[model samples]
Target: MEHKALWTLKFFNFDPSKTQNKRRRQMLELEEMWLHAYDSSRSYKEQLKSKWSGPFIVKSVRPHGAIELVDPAANDQQSSWVVNGQRLKHYLGGEVERLSTVMKLVDP
Candidate 1:
């Protein structure tokens, strides 16, 4: 068994204060990107959708210096999961961080 990175991600909350209609459009873009990235990048052992849960859970891993996204749900849906370089290492955490396949992030 391996220790997993327990991330405190906030995708469902936070408001951008943009016009509601524009915000909705922006959110849709983020959502699409998140779904696409998860489908392509994460390992099959992980769940990439909003509705799934597991003991070996995977949460949304944000980019470095990415302040709590105004709307993580929207941002995650628009941007790609930054799965390169030290990014993966940061999320994996501790000893399990060495095992790249142990966990992953999905579009929340």
Candidate 2:
């Protein structure tokens, strides 16, 4: 029991004050866009998967730099999930441009 306690103490010896601040200053902005990291384990074929998914909108910012995402299609809270800032990447319309090009090819 003493060994276990000492191990636990050593494992949690991190200083809360020394934790690095979030590099993302835009997280606090309302309706900011983000791409959520995808769970690649769910894919049956390893090569047919993307690293991140969705251009989800930021619904709200939590106290510790966590963010609540908004469902763009549904516009409801039912399908939303909270994720840490590090797990997200800014969605800069590259996907949208690709989608538009695909749509043009199909329609034309």
Candidate 1, residues 1-108: lDDT per residue as tens digits? 123322323333534665687889999999999998887777553544432221122334456633221223453544433232342223343443333555677999
Model 1, residue 44: what's the lDDT?
53
Q: Report the poorest 10 consecutive residues by lDDT, candidate 2.
A: 28-37
lDDT by candidate, in order shown: 0.46, 0.62
TM-score of 1: 0.23
* TM-score of model 2 vs. true structure: 0.36
What's the lDDT of the predicted structure labeled candidate 1?
0.46
Cα deviation of 11, candidate 1, in Å = 29
Pairs in steric clash, model 1: 30-77, 30-78, 31-77, 31-78
Query: Which consecutive 10 residues in model 1 have the weakest lDDT in total?
Result: 50-59
Candidate 2, residue 5: the lDDT equals 96
